[model samples]
Target: MATAPTASNLPLFYKDLVPLSSVDHADFHARPLDSADFLINQHAVPLTSDEFVSASRHYPIVFSAGDNPVPLALMGLNEGINTFVSEEGKLINPVYVPAYIRRYPFMLARLRPDTDELSLCFDPTSGAIGKFDEGDVLFVDGKPSDAVNNILEFCKNFEEAGQRTGQFVEELQKADLLMDGEVSIQADGYEQPFVYRGFKMVDETKLRELRGDVLRKMMQNGILALIFAHLFSLQLMREIFAEQVKAGKMPAVTVAPTTA
Candidate 1:
């Protein structure tokens, strides 16, 4: 099956992306990411399987639509509505921030479709990045600085986590446990309930019917807990919808009964 494009398919908040080559970006430096307002417009963020435990505590974790499903942490139900991010871009909730977000402005990318090699890249348009008089330098004496090395390490870790997440999804797919998910919420004074769709989720019935050996293997590998975390997080969808209503940012759409 062909893979579907994900929210992270292209680097978000990246206006201009250039490979961090010593010859090209020799004088580049990176300023501290002091604020998170950049994430305010992001309604959903990609998540690695490792983030399920902590992410489930705050955002609802669901699978993105695609052949190779990627987990997503939903900050809000509607577009341009990140309930966790304040107007100031500060995170309103004290929850585990996904590594995908923390590694922003810096990520590993394949410059060409034909190549398997990944390069360290950064968003040149980000004001936080530049060759300013004061900031962490990207290279020292033509060599990568400690700060640059640290960023590389973080991106490497993120890539590894993504691979693990892919394996988890593959296991679920092999078991045929994923199904289209929907949720309905009732708001006061609203005659009909708001229904949301277009996301994938684990089917509890199929999961419960798995072979004993398969279930034990999943438990031993800790995938079972992650699955449960995702299931439990679905309840937060209603809460996120309520937050949108409270903030008066809910999109104007007709409410309809949920389909089976």
Candidate 2:
């Protein structure tokens, strides 16, 4: 087994990155939920500049399930959360676009929202990142593992539907291109709900630069530091769970409590 990480093993092993804070909680919502719903109602709402700063100041890491707050990771960078702080610490809204989606073939073309202006969208049905528009109907696929499959299917369905309606054009097909980057087979499947620490949001330009830098450093590091940290924290939770099992303090695999 890999040695458990400690303060001494860190920053160096992780390329000098350290978590801003840590949480002692052992609970993780292992059953994957609808990411689209979590992103919209829990994530997109109440993300004002004031709330970001206030929450960040109170805790170096801020987590949310929709609008609910939670804890940070023990180490490394966590998920990318919308931010209200710049590198200089000024309050500003941070727009988020995952590197995979940004570089993915469809996201760059057919998947991109018509407007360059940043907005939040929760769509498990789309393989590409999407921006929300008023009155555009959305469907939720609650099964997490099926999320990506649904997205791929949606694209195929969309193309077929467009053709049936005479909306398909050869020129539009030209716009469909995937980023040269590959999505890891390991990355397949729905992600369970969990805590993220030190998620900072930035503008689209800044996000692009940061993501590029992170991607460049990914192989050098196991995972990007932020994502690595979150993964590490999840592993740590497993460790905690294992220890608890040994002590009979908890069951081997405890399902998350639906309430509180």
Candidate 3:
């Protein structure tokens, strides 16, 4: 029998997830968000396989019919918003986010390319979220009447926040830090002639079929591979922690872990 990989061996475990070649913007459009589509369509994600197994094995919160069902629009919007606050952190400094990433444990997040025009999916059986570059922006998973306007508003916010994040990451790229890296940035939000420090940000809206082009490239390279990897890592982290507890390697926490 083979021994399972542990946290100590996690660096090797995740090494395979990295691309053998540089992941360029062109490649991202083709792949269009790695494993995220499998877990949930552009419209909905019921529960992951691991989530289902975990839920079946443990008790979770239950509600009555009178209780309101969780709004999918809110769920989706909240996901983006949470990522913004977490990854970008109010844009205090263009360099803060990347600096934080190097100093601490942070979750990874990805948004499909703006040009793809793909949005929302809902199959009670297999929910997903992706781009639809060919069509006018439409929320298909649920009724646009139900979540379309909401998601559009969220999309606008997402674009704005993404630009800010890009600015932050750009600063990191210019820094001398040993771990400095370039974040995947899509020129989707830059509109109007905006000049900062004598450099003009390209107007993404003017690019014909740019979002679709970006989406196509992403699909080729493995869409949102890093984000999905982080999600899977969370699951692995739990498994490793549980195993460590069983082996009496560390004490369990009664209070929540402190955060900065």
Candidate 4:
């Protein structure tokens, strides 16, 4: 599973980022996405902690393997395979799309590395923002239009949710609750169980052994609910695997050579 982009790494689905400006794009209008083809091959998408409750219902919410692990919603068991999305970029299953996907083509990003200030930016290659005659206007009379204001509001909310997500991950790390994750599925007629790895998850064993006060505090603060949501979502892994099989995207089995 792939993690979200860092300062040095390019964000998924974005080829190039440019700050949105009223001056440079007075006549530009942001068009609604016509298709979800961009997500057709994306098996996993980043998730903010605030999205756990909603996203967990449809996709398995697991963490990336690293020191600062971020949450991710798995759409398929294997890389570059998305069973939920169709060839035409439509959803085969009417599932709750992650905010990370909804926020695509537009996001609030830092313009400089030294400062904390953020600017509204969009992916130029997205083809969503353009000088169209009929679409949401970006600017009017040298000022940002209502549409731009709305986008800014959404981006701000996303940023705030991202910060909260970071805090939730920190709490898990502090409690030593995260561990390397693995899932084993034995499909019918298969001699070997398919083992999947390369991700992380909350260690329920450690969680159950937490001290009374820590558990109480976590419960009161709503952290326990998130952990349970993640654990419950893990069951859907088999469902996704089944979907992949039905879609004919399941990887072929490799039988090891047996010595005489």
Candidate 5:
């Protein structure tokens, strides 16, 4: 979820934020971009529960270790190595690109601490928006253009989905279903297996032992499918490790995963 914007703690990929204004940015336009150089060294991205189904197909959906854990999509098992994306940030293959990635440069954020209202903001350093000669215009006749409107709508939907995701995680925590996660990948001719940790996952035993009524409620509310999606995606952890080894980015026999 997009959170408060500040000088010291800008979110991943954002260098600075400025609220979009029709008067100030009347001539600014957005250009098409096919790459994200910012994601080069990032191993994990914030994922919403709504993305569990699609993201589960490409990345292992797991929880961060903390009191208020959020879902994350693991792009790689080792540090600074993303298997699906190239070193330059062009996606290496066709995969489910996360909305968090797609929403780059544009996100809903509160502009002031005194107000509860959120404003449309963009990372000015991205270079994706400017007074470009070609590409989508941000404003027309002092009103937001269709392209800008679409971006706002997408950001709004992302924030809404974040709320639902928080509720789902709260349920998991209340049920005591999350546990520290561990995975060991043994490469050929190696005596010791590579151990990866620093993440959390659902406790399958606890999930199976949930009361029937609770399970029924989860199913009725679509939480059951999301949980299963996360559980099923964990199998991809080894696949990611193999990819890291193939790319020569794997650590020496054993190593822990990057906590970030």
Candidate 6:
């Protein structure tokens, strides 16, 4: 169960959102994505179901803690630390970028809770959007321009992917396959290892005990493969931890007893 995203839960760098409208933003335009420095501080980026395979190749996909468990790509061991991003805001490695990050500055959000309708919105502070004389126009002839239409299409696809991700998470929860997640790393010259917890992972024991019909269904639906991808990606936790050490950002505390 993924937690409902609130304004607080919205990704970093998104601030002062206003619904995009032809009437209000007739002259709005967007510049090219010139830099990725904004993503430097994000240690984990949300992952949609469609991203599992490619994301698994680059990042350790793990479920966030709590009743609502959104899949997250671990970029760093600790919060506000993205080791993959260099000082210049460029990605340090050639890893698959999560759509959540790629779709930034533009998001489909429900302006009100009573209605299910979503509105196209953007971060006014993002600097990528403005009333620029050059760049992709957001509106033309009192209607959305091609750029705006494309952004809407992307948002629509993201919403659909989010729905699929939710269903996948629901299946995992229904089968009670989730267990508390933990990881430990012992960096060189460090006597005690650093331990990380407060996440969830598939319980292999529970998964193996699933009924034949359920297992078969999961396999047929490709959920089983996704599960394995998640499991396999856990091995990257050590790699991420090592990167943190190399960056001189290792945690100060020593390992403690594993927590659930």
TM-scores, in order shown?
0.90, 0.20, 0.22, 0.94, 0.95, 0.92
lDDT of 5 by residue, 1-260 (tens): 11223357888779989999999999999996768888787778889999999999999988887567889898887656778889777998889989999999999999889998999999998989988898899999999999999999999999999999999999988888999888888888688898887788999999999999999999999989999999999999989888888898877538674443
Residue lDDT tens for model 1, 103-202: 8899999999999899899877767788788899889889999999999999999999999999999999999999988777888888888777767899
Which regions in candidate 6 have their CA more than 4 angstroms from the true location?
Answer: 1-12, 255-260
For model 6, residues 179-217, the per-residue Cα lDDT tens digits are 888787777887777788867999989998999999999
Q: What is the lDDT of residue 115 in candidate 5?
A: 96
**Decreasing TM-score order of the candidates:** 5, 4, 6, 1, 3, 2
Work out how many backbone clashes candidate 5 has.
0
Tell me the whole-model lDDT of each prediction, alpha carbons only: 0.83, 0.27, 0.24, 0.86, 0.86, 0.84
Clashes of each: 1, 5, 46, 0, 0, 4
- Candidate 4: lDDT of 188? 83
Q: Write the per-residue lDDT of candidate 3 for residues 1-260, one digit (tens) a residue.
A: 01123354421112122211122211211111222222121111122222222332221111111111110110011111211122223421132122111211111223244564433222221112224343233333332432335444544554454454444334323331112111121122333321111111112233233457654653564432322332233233233234334434332222212111
User: Alpha carbon lDDT of residue 106, candidate 5?
Assistant: 95
Worst 10 residues of 1 by lDDT: 1-10
Global Cα lDDT for candidate 3: 0.24
Stretches off by above 4 angstroms in model 1 are 1-9, 254-260
259, model 3: CA deviation in Å? 27
lDDT of 6 at 120: 95
lDDT (Cα, 0-100) at 121 in candidate 3: 21
Please report how far candidate 4 places residue 124 from its true position, in Å.
0.9
